[model samples]
Target: MALTGKLEIDVEIKAPPDKFHDMFCNRPHHSQHACNDKIKGCDLHDGDWGTVGSVIFWSYVRDGKAKTLKEVVEAIDSEKNSITFRVLEGDVMKDFKSYVITIQASPKSGGEGSIVHWTMEYEKQHEGIAHPEDALQFAVEISKDIDSHLTQGN
Candidate 1:
């Protein structure tokens, strides 16, 4: 069986695309306030926000377990409104040799809201390990939380 795989998920949000993209690029730490239940907090370990090669540490609860992750900002494309992160260490590294996630927020074709797209790519340590579907679900939920947080005042 193949050991490398990818998963893509998209969620619709009432928040504007620019604001949604800004959260990922320059204000990821705000996630703690937006969704403390899942995202405990995030801190900058090196460099600055919205810059390539920045290192960030994340704390969160998943599957009723607390987990930590260290990731580097791999790429950023403002025109595309996307950011890519490469996981250096974390709960997921226990099962995957390498993991990368890319997220993009774009304007919906019809009008007012945005569409957030999450893509995860991984190489499993063993064929027995399952895919990261739960992570995708978490992303979806977090997108909603962020949407609500951003749209609450409007």
Candidate 2:
């Protein structure tokens, strides 16, 4: 099996695309409010939110286990409503040599919703480790939670 892999997942949400994009880019620290069960909190370590080169720390749960990640905002494109994060430190580094997560939101055609796409790219430390399906699932679940939270106006 190849040591490097990429995973992509698309989610359809009933919330506005701009709102979703803004959440990830401008107020990621508030994600816990949308999915408290999965995300404990996110804190700004350096720089400002919604800008490239900013450092952010995440506290979250995966497979019932608590974990943390420190990531730097690698890119942000308002025109595409996309944000990319490069993992700088975390448990993920133990199994993967490098990891990058990119999320994009686009308005649904003829609708009042959006299509959210999450892409994860990583290189495994060795061939024995399995693909990061669990991580993709985590992103999907968080997307759903955020959708629900926004649709319910909570």
Please provide TM-scores, in order, for all candidate models, with all chains considered together: 0.98, 0.97
Tens-digit lDDT track of model 1 for 94-116:
99999999999999998999999
**Over the stretch 1-154, how does candidate 2's per-residue lDDT look in tens digits?**
9999999999999998889999999999888999999999899999999999999999998888999999999999999999999999998999999999999999998888999999999999999999999887788899999999888943
**In terms of TM-score, how similar is model 2 to the real structure?**
0.97
**True lDDT of residue 9, candidate 2:** 92
Give the deviation of candidate 2 from the true structure as CA RMSD: 1.1
Give model 1 RMSD, 1 decimal.
0.7
Backbone clashes for every candidate come to 0, 0
Off by over 4 Å in 1: none
Give candidate 1's error at residue 146 in angstroms.
0.7
Cα lDDT computed for each candidate against the true fold: 0.95, 0.93
- In TM-score terms, candidate 1 sits at 0.98
What value of lDDT does candidate 1 attain over all alpha carbons? 0.95
